[model samples]
Target chain A: MAIKVAILGYGTVGEGVYKGIQNHQEQLIEKLGDAVEVAGILVRDPLKKRDVQPGTFITTRFEEILAIPGLHAVFEAIVGKEPGYTYLSQCIEKGCHVITANKVLFAKYGNELLKKSKQHGVHIGYEATTAGAVPIIRTLQELLKVNRVTRIQGILNGTSNFILTEMRANRLSFGEALKLAQDNGYAEANPENDVEGKDAACKLKILCQLAFGCTPDWEEVEVEGIAAITSGEVQKAEAEGFRYKHIADIRAEGGKLKASVKPIAVSSAHPLFSVEGVDNAITLETSLAGNLTLQGAGAGKFPTASAMLEDFSAILEKSLRTKIHLLSARVPV
Target chain B: MAIKVAILGYGTVGEGVYKGIQNHQEQLIEKLGDAVEVAGILVRDPLKKRDVQPGTFITTRFEEILAIPGLHAVFEAIVGKEPGYTYLSQCIEKGCHVITANKVLFAKYGNELLKKSKQHGVHIGYEATTAGAVPIIRTLQELLKVNRVTRIQGILNGTSNFILTEMRANRLSFGEALKLAQDNGYAEANPENDVEGKDAACKLKILCQLAFGCTPDWEEVEVEGIAAITSGEVQKAEAEGFRYKHIADIRAEGGKLKASVKPIAVSSAHPLFSVEGVDNAITLETSLAGNLTLQGAGAGKFPTASAMLEDFSAILEKSLRTKIHLLSARVPV
Candidate 1:
């Protein structure tokens, strides 16, 4: 048997998902016990020259993709909150699981969407929403079962960190570092979300809700971007044996949860002190597990696709309790 | 309905598992959709003083634990291989899922036992058998689905790492570091398995089997202990802007896997560079996700017990896809 899937965008992550399914179909089949087929792709312009699997349906209409029979999952990567959430909600209504890399939408509507998916007997995976390939969401979901998490600190935005790292490493001005990030394809043409701390704010909201089990008021989270951090300040921190990092921090202090996203100076011993480039790092301070730090590529085609694929694998594994990793039945001991 | 579980030992890990079950029953019920009760315990001496919940059965005999009504899972933390293997085998024969924290027994018998349990319509979880609380096993299981893992380097043994870090930071002799590790409860009195690199060898074998999909020949793994490192060597490495760490490395070289456990010098930017004390770290260089590193408490009661409980959560989650994290079914859009 083969599993049918769809994609909702034709950007970097969408292309990666399509390629990931095509290139690793054998592995997916081995692990999923079935071939995964990208049966349909929803793009804004069907006439655009895009690399797609031969004979797969390409359409600009979401209804055309949703009409596909036996669709198992949808990988969404569109850049907005409205249509993306609506398409995903529609997919859930049709009983197909949805996996996404859109944190902006999820941070706001994740509670409703997750609750809605449960009501529809479907799975929704957003591991790619925060830290691209870090698996923080799944880790928290598993750990929160038997542990009391005290605090969480993360370098959730890769662009901001990349800019900070560049400013410190090469003594580039903020505008120069931002230009370098754009030239290297690390930043979008309009890099407001990544530079202004809104991206990290959304990611923190999603992480905090999962880690603390409450939706915090967005207004209460203090937000500060690295735009105002001067080259001199970066050098000063370096001279003081510290590095400036755009950190998204959430902690419970005296029974109150405080959240912030800003540039902070950290010493050499910090887990994220050496985290450079466009990498993401997360530290979970839990009572039982002590401190756990996970680092991975914060944003990229393959990394985001990797998280979505993991979430898809999990959804399929749970759908039927498939014996992909289970060995054959043997005689009694 | 209440789920019944059993423990095969009553030492540090066993007591942690017991207390974890008692203390986190609320969270367990909230997550697993039913109360988790430690039904029975298999201890060496039944009369030994221990903290246990009232009305729970404690016995010296394995048969007594197997006799517990409605037993669902058995957590094994006994020392050595002989009886731990036999007892776990019996648990599988009785159609109960099994989780373990004994690496020595598992490194040898895991493949055979896992295959055997599959035939019995039961599950086997050994996350606690490797790095404590790191979740590397589960993370690898999920990532290996699509990502081609190229190499894995880990600080797998806490005692070895603790001693090495101490030797470097305090400029202590090998014997002095070993004594300090023992006093801190990081190393055992007879710490041959840890200091001699046998513990790391076992963990590396387990990780390689999962990542590479085939077990390498046990005799071919180049194992080197940390006992030979002098204080001068540690200082030399430090002076050269490097730290000597007990590293377990396995990478595919020219289509063949090379495995080794030894003291290696790593600079500041290395993922495991600042990993000090008893903290364990692992870096997986994957073809798709880039470099993913995870660090956490390497060896402890709560951490090890946390792994077992996560494994238990997975086992129960697979048994019946209860709506623990799922909300009430809602109307379609």
Candidate 2:
């Protein structure tokens, strides 16, 4: 049976997901022993010619995707809260599995959406919500099942990391670095989320939930972005034999989750100090594994899309099971 | 049907495998939906009276382990080339899945064993062979399946990392730091394998095999260690705003594999710089995923053991027809 999928946004990540799915079609088919196809793509501008295969049915309305017959899954690449939230909810309510790259949505409303997905008997995957391509979510949820995680720390935001790396390397001020990042396509025009630590804070919330099984309040996460740190401070830190890294830390201690996103003065010996440029790395300290770290491209078209493809694979596997658990009743927290 | 496992080598990593298997019993049951048990343990001293649970049949003989009726899997944690190699071959011949934590055996004899395992219709896993608990092998094999990997740069050995970290932070000489590492249980008495880059080189062979599907001649890999580095050089690099890191790099360029293991001057922009003290990190550059980095405890009882446990889980899943093809067959150049 061919699993039909609808992409909610035909942006960079969405296009990458489409391209990756097509490129690895043979291997994916061999792995799953089945076929998958992209049924429809929901684009804001249907007339916009994309780099993707031209025959892919493009639509402007969200309902057109939901209305597509035999749609088994939805890949939500649309960022922000309103329409992505509504579209994903509708898809889940209609019994379609959802694979999303929206960190803002998942961090804010994951608990709610997960609850709804459970009730509808579907799986909601947001692996691309954190590190672009690193399978940290699956690693924590599946592979590291027996391990009790103590702390989650790493470079979670790429734009901030890029800015910090630029500040440390080129001795550029935050503003100058931010401009360079924007010019390099590493940062969005309104780089508020990436600059103010909100991007990392959102990722921290998702990571904490998976590692600790506790959804931390985003507001409680102490955030200090790279915007506050001057080039002088970065140079001074180097002179003092320290590295300034934008670190997102979530510690599960004494039955409470304490989390923060900030620029920290890490000694040269610290693992976080070595993470440079726009790359993302996560160090997981667990009872069984001790300390494990994963690093990769935090955000990029291909990395994010590669993650989405994995989620697609997971959904395809789930579809093969006899008693499909699309939705389960929300467990009381 | 319950999948039975026999553990070979009752050392630190071996004990960790036992404890991890025991600790995650309930979760394993839930995930696998089957009963699993440790049928036997291969130990040098049967009467050592360690912290492991009672009733586990302990034996010093390879014949005894092979004789265990219905033994489905074997986890070999004994380090070295002789008995570990011989015993693992015996297990594969018996149609039992072989999971190993021995890097030397894998580096030298992986091809032969893999061929044998394929012929015998059994899987062989060596996730713990490199990077302790880090999932580099699996990441290369599974997560980045669609992407063509270009380069892999990592801090593959923890002992050398610890030594380098100490030399930089405390201004200790390489020899002095190595002494401290040995005293602190991070380095073996004969630390030549780690200090000379042989340990990392061996692990790099496995990484190259998975990442590029061609194992470069081990001798061709340019090897350099931190032994030649001094506190003065570390300070000199610091003065120039660069950090010294021991890095193993393998890249596929124009149908040829270029590999190297050395201590390089890394700017604050490289992901390998954040990897510190006994922790390992691998940065993979792929066509689809761009660049992805994974970091973790490169070596430790629990971390390595956690990897072995994952292999055990893989064995159980394979038994139930959920064959996880984490690695493709190495294509000979």
Candidate 3:
């Protein structure tokens, strides 16, 4: 039997997932021992000029795509809450696994989704939602099984990191770097989420939930973005043998977690000091394993798509026991 | 319901595994949804003064432990190949899963073990055999499922890295550094495997088998250890803003793999440049995910034991499908 999956949005990640599945069909089949077919693609505009695989149906109506028989997984790449959240919940309720790139929805309602998943016995894969290509979620889920976690910190946002990297490396001002990032498609026109640290804060909440098994309110996280950081400070930090990085940090002790996202100066000895450009790096401090660091592409189409595929493959093999990394009980502040 | 397991050879790793399992018993029980008990321990001296659980059984004979009922997994921590290999094979033949920290046995006979495991439908967990606490084996196994790995290079040996780090940071010669490493318990008295690069070569073979499903002869890999790295060269490289790192490299393209272990000069831009002390770091260049780097302690009693427990927890959940990351068929080389 072929594994049938649907893409919930026709955006960059959705298109990338479609293309990746199409391109690596044979290799995926070889590894999975079965053909994985894209059944339908849910789009707001069905007439949008897009490259799609043959026999793949495109529809604007969620009901049309959900009506497909034997849909094993739904790839949720749509933005914002509302319909994306509703579609994913319906998929899980119907016993279909969900793979998503929507960090905002996950950060907010992850705990609820996980409880629903546990009740329905379905997997929710959010690998693409956090660090794009970096498999930090899976790493934490697997390695932290036998180790006591102490601290989890990382450069989780690529847009903010990219802007900071441009400012420091090219001697550009924050505005100049922001402009460059926007021009290069690294930042959005309305880049409040990236500039004001909301993006990294959301990811930090997700990470803390996975690492410490505790959910933190996104509103309570002390967040400071890159917009307030000056090039002089960046240069001064560099001259003082330190690098300024936008970091999402969470420290856990006695089952309590404190989370923050801010522009932090780090010495050369720090792992996050070297993470630049659109790169993401996470350092995990554990009692047994010592300090472990994982670095990779923080965000992009292909990388995010590849992450989704990993989750898809794991779900297919019936190996993904942890349904939602971020979906657990919220710790009362 | 309870999952039962055993430990072979009550040495550093074996003892560490015991303590780790005992300390994380509650967490393991929660994760596995069942009580995981260490049923018996195989040792040369059962009466040796060691800290263990009150009800834990210890015996000097492997057959004694093997005769225990409901043994789900056996952890192999004994050094060398002979009786360890035979015991592991017998365990697999009897349909019990095996987890090992024996790198030599893995590099030498991984192919045969994998074939036997497949024939008997048993899992062979060797995450502890390479880069002890870093979880590189699991990372490669999970991440490479969706990405095409091109090149993998790393500082795989803790002793070599410790020596090189000491040689640079303290301006010590290779002999002085080796003495320091031994004094710190970082290197064994017979450090030939680490100092001659054979240990790294073995690890590289294991990594290659996991990454490319192919294994090159361990002896065939170009081996050059830090024994020849003088403090003069180290200072010279440092003065020129480069670091000399002993790297185990494997490149796969067009379904052919080339493996080598050598001391390479790396600039600050290189991910392996700042990896110091007993730390091990690996940089993987893939087709879709870009450059991914993972760093941590490559060897230690507690770290390697934690890796073993990870396998134990996975086996308890019956989620470990591909057990032997490196134990696979040899391609037509």
Regions of model 1 farther than 4 Å from truth = A253-255, A322-333, B54-56, B322-333
Model 3, position A225, has a per-residue lDDT of: 93
- Highest DockQ, which number? 1
lDDT of 2 at B172: 89
CAPRI grade of model 1? acceptable
**Which DockQ value does candidate 1 get?**
0.38
lDDT of 3 by residue, B194-217 (tens): 999989988888888888887766
Candidate by candidate, in order, the iRMS in Å equals 7.5, 11.0, 12.2
**Could you tell me how far off, in angstroms, the CA of residue B8 lies in candidate 1 after the best superposition?**
2.0
lDDT of 1 by residue, A1-333 (tens): 799999999899999899888888877888778899899999888788887757888999999999999999999999889899999999999999999999999998999999999999899999999999988998887544677788999999999999999999899999999999999999999999899999999999999999888855678778998999999999999999999999999998888888889999999888788889899999998867778899999999999998988889888877755332222121111
Give candidate 3's iRMS in Å, 1 decimal. 12.2
Best candidate according to lDDT: 1
lDDT of 3 by residue, A92-205 (tens): 988898998899999888888989988997888888889989889988876568788889888988889998888888889999999998898888899999989998988888
